[model samples]
Target: MIPNVIRRVEFQYCKLHFLLRTRPLSHVMYSGSTGLVTPVADPSLLDCSRAAAQDVDGFAIISNFVSSEEEEQLMVDIRRTLRGRKYLYDHWDGAIEGYSETEKSNWSESNTPVIQRLKAVAAAAVTDKVVVPLEQVHVLDLAEDGHIKPHVDSVKFCGEVICGISLLSDSVMQLQHEEYPDRWIHALLSRFSLYIMRGVIRYKYTHAIPTNENSVFKGERITKQRRVSVISRTQPVHS
Candidate 1:
């Protein structure tokens, strides 16, 4: 028998080779300059099909959460808002430890720019599908070099349910813990895809995207596309 190490490497290489030849790369997934197993038929709500991918805590990845027309419009709106605005070093500080107070202060005034259509669609998903009310709403715009480090959002300020929609490009977001540093839960945020994090996914596993040049998925190098994410949360709750 081949050594286990060689076996693993050979298996992964074969898998990767098969994927590259059989599936079209999704510019939407890493941005397809490129593609997965069967996705749910309608991802407007949580689908049991992805239950296996969820960690004990809980996480959901919804593909085609928004239509192509909506995505195009959202991109226009996202670019407009992103223009002429000064971006800060980190938008995640408040969601993590120690900076809860500072982050909470901006919450009230921040929802003004989020497009109504986008907000309505997300809220509909939450209320109709997830059966929860919408709460905090904001955007995280990633520059070519921008990415939020691995950090847990503070439960003291943010709510239990967190939902977000990607715009402009595709990027990878990962979840992992210090205890199991070697294991990572990755969500490929394709443009217009919806990602919801709650339960263990929210409180336990820390999530982040590496800085632009450092981005990768499945051991493959990827380009950083300027990403605009509209994120919302419910009232603060115990996670």
Candidate 2:
């Protein structure tokens, strides 16, 4: 019993260390009962998995999940793989243009370490018992003028959790509730940051990156640039 207790404590401590790399500038949530928006003071996981009344439920982010050196190396791998590839301008919303995307069923030998690192951090950050990365890794490159419009992932495509690593540049992603438009939050994704969306936020909120204007977070304007994201989603569970 004593040895089991010790192992549990160690696990929690390691999970905390992986999550609290940087504080979020702005991560507010809507209070359904009071009909007011409240700030999620800290999103760090303290005890085992569940914490009491800590509002920011489905969305979480670690500002710096990977080191600068690792980020550069990922970029190197991306460029090598996507050399001379043509960007697509086809989308139903017509929200994105001059963007290139590819799905990697498996990572190369050089990228396996980083991929494993992402999986490890993702498992530690969320409350879910099982977090399985999908077979394909979604690699998306947005040109200087490209941005993602507000949209939700198809239920058939992926499961409850979506984890992504921001590479090359910093940007802002806004989440607005589908029913209550006023209820929203802005997540500032810094370079090399990792953002995870699950449960309610994944199904209900529509996320988008604005291109026409500067993004505001904590009263600071964020300008977008050429950005690349290495994203992985869990396999969709059939209901």
Candidate 3:
């Protein structure tokens, strides 16, 4: 009869060999010290269909939120407003890089209509409770090479709902689960699109805008350009 230790080792070796043959080398992790081969859990392992089927709560994107003409006009307004302003590379919060940000409590005559429309869209997206847009809106200008790192918004600043309208250029936003790195999804923020994040998406996922080098969506490469976003937040209602 075969010794128990030998039998166990033989079984493990067969299992390892089977896994190495069936799976891609990129999916396997080898430990040099223990001579063990383990399968790595990566988001890429799951196909796009399966990942899209996951019940992601409180995340929605509205494509073509504004007309082409309206988008052009809005871009002009943004450029004029931010012209000649010095951008901050080192922010106190350390949330952004190569970015220029300012707060807009009031919109100009040409820009007020867009702000009102954004508020309306935001109000309709979140149905649980009424979300009042704060007087101050966040205007961010991302440089051509800039990117936002993965991070969750501070609870002290905003409430449950966060609304943002992407303008000027197209890009992809990646939201990864805070607890499980392998669970992630990418949302394409096309020009003039509005994205809403609330509840689980707002609190549980760390959202980021990767650089052009690593930007991808649904297996297609994405080339990022200078983008601008007008972000609005609801008042903080602490329980």
Candidate 4:
């Protein structure tokens, strides 16, 4: 049993695992095992659980979010567009986090072709009136052993949803509920795949990429390839 101060409850068994949390706590729940279900007794947990279960009505998955060929071209274009730009910060080797404020100041008025194309792609995804155009976006590149610490995006962003498109390689993205820290949901992000996370899944859970030098999925430790991610969100962005 693992209890999280932030409203996560976790139960783990030899072949199963369970996670639970609330909205104020981060709306994601991850389950790894098959049986032995338990009811959430905490009032805060119950509130979040209810919200998460209810929020699934609008969930969407856009597989083949980007094509490998398009991703390759985009990488080249972004690199060229970003050349000599001072706002690009190295969050990790081969990974840069773009600042929206800075980007707006430096590139928004440029009318660059690549930027225009990107905007078009973003526009297509914002079909719902409630889903506004993402004001901020970030790009991440990961090589072998590269990873991010488990964390939830800051709530101040008012970001009700997060959309991520994979550009290269295939990797696993893990989401864990603070309630059930030991249990997790692993999503394989294939090149060109698009994943949209919202509702409880977006706000209530912590997400991360493990830093194992050689990660074993299923039974093999395949070398990691250079991978890029385009993260789109509505913001008041925060670190």
Candidate 5:
């Protein structure tokens, strides 16, 4: 299988890695302009609700989740939080080397006031579900051409519902499951938007942001840009 996407690398930093589409050596290589060949997805697995898009199992994509002014404030808070931290260039792929993965952090959630507002929004989104205590906060600073490979968060480090707020750019989030790994639902995540993936959507399917993916928002097709994603997960409260 081959994907026909081309990436124009805007920035390449130390230890920063990019995912290039490739098949195992077992498959013969013959390159041409073939279309994206993916299996037909099960309709039951996808929920494309655009207006504050959400699914029954708790996956959500809320446009304008926060206002521009609020976004600016959040960014300021984030910059402050990241100002004195040291980031390692090595990508953790559950291995030593050769694999480049997303740059991540678990320390930002506890120090920011903006996180409190995001917590409230999550509570309101899933009214039936109560917001639990904040677990580890995962932050990713991706350059214009940066993106994530498809994978799920380890339950050991997180809990049921996961919420993330996008800042500074718009991108498409691709979701898929083990049963239909080849198929995906490309959802648009606008800047200042909040998206939650939970329940079956969280466990059954893996989510990713592709480097070259384009999203249509306000009827305009826009390319992916630099992004700062602030992610939080819920922790099971033990009494």
Candidate 6:
């Protein structure tokens, strides 16, 4: 079982622009360039008020999971490899679909050296009982304001454990539990951060990034920076 500090956190407000005022609790605020402000409530103090209670979802966000140097080099390689490649869509793949704007996929199978490095890192990161091979990995690129609607990965295509490594800029991912539709979890995925979702969190939840605004927090609307995500799965369908 994960420790108490690592438990799930629930946020009171879901709006892109809102302030959370809780006395005696330290708050961190992120300002977007569009003059929108999102106030991050103190998770520790969130337990006090019953009225402030929100749905709790099992999603883990680990900031700075990869070193800065590693993230930079990986992104550089991704850009170089994608320059001349054709982007395609396979309906059989469930994580993403439909007329999405400015996005690319399937770098995990590319011959780029940086992609090779990513495979190495993913292999090393899977220390659990389930060993996920590199062949099941998938890479994605999202442009500014690009959004992916809420959807769950097909059970057959992914492992029991799913890991997403963020590269460049930041994004707010919203997740909802199928069993508890009322409650949702919003996470700020920063550059080099890794988010791991498993157990009920893995199979029972739907996740997506919103497309309306570039940044969720006020005054934080910095220009959209190209972003990449390396998705690693530990449980292969064939094995």
lDDT of 4 by residue, 104-208 (tens): 312322223323323333333323333443554566555544666667777775466666666767766656666754444555555665555665566667766
| Superposed model 6: Cα runs more than 4 Å off | 1-57, 85-136, 212-224, 237-239
Question: What is each predicted model's overall lDDT from 0 to 1?
Answer: 0.52, 0.66, 0.69, 0.45, 0.52, 0.50
Give per-residue lDDT, candidate 5, residue 106.
Answer: 33
| TM-scores, each model vs. reference | 0.60, 0.74, 0.74, 0.55, 0.60, 0.58
So what's the TM-score on candidate 4?
Answer: 0.55
Number of residue pairs clashing in candidate 6, backbone atoms closer than 3 angstroms, sequence gap of 3 or more or interchain: 12
Off by over 4 Å in 1: 1-57, 79-83, 90-132
**Candidate 6 lDDT over residue span 1-239, tens digit each:** 22321221111122211222221112323222222223344352112123213323234454455566667666665667567544333334444432222223344322233333333333333333534544645667766546567788777766656667788877777666677656556667777766656555567768776664644533344333656787776655564
Tens-place lDDT per residue, model 2, 20-130, is 333321253222223232344544311111221232456766556666777887888888888999877677557667689888756555566557555544454344356
Residue 22 displacement (Å), model 5: 44
- For every model shown, the clashing-pair count is 6, 0, 0, 13, 0, 12
lDDT of 2 at 210: 77
Better of 3 and 6 by TM-score: 3
Sum up the clashes in candidate 3.
0
Task: Tell me the lDDT of candidate 5.
Answer: 0.52
Q: Least accurate stretch of 10 residues (summed lDDT) in model 6? A: 8-17
Residues 1-239 of candidate 1 have per-residue lDDT tens digits of 23553454344334433432343212111111112223233222222223334453256555655556656665565555556666565443533221111111132112232233223323333222332334435656667666677888776756556777777777777677546655457666666776767655677778887765666766655566777667766666443
User: Which portions of model 4 show Cα errors greater than 4 Å?
Assistant: 1-61, 82-129, 212-214, 218-222, 236-239
Q: List the candidates ranked by lDDT, beginning with the highest.
A: 3, 2, 5, 1, 6, 4
> Candidate 3, after superposition: displacement of residue 74 in Å?
2.3
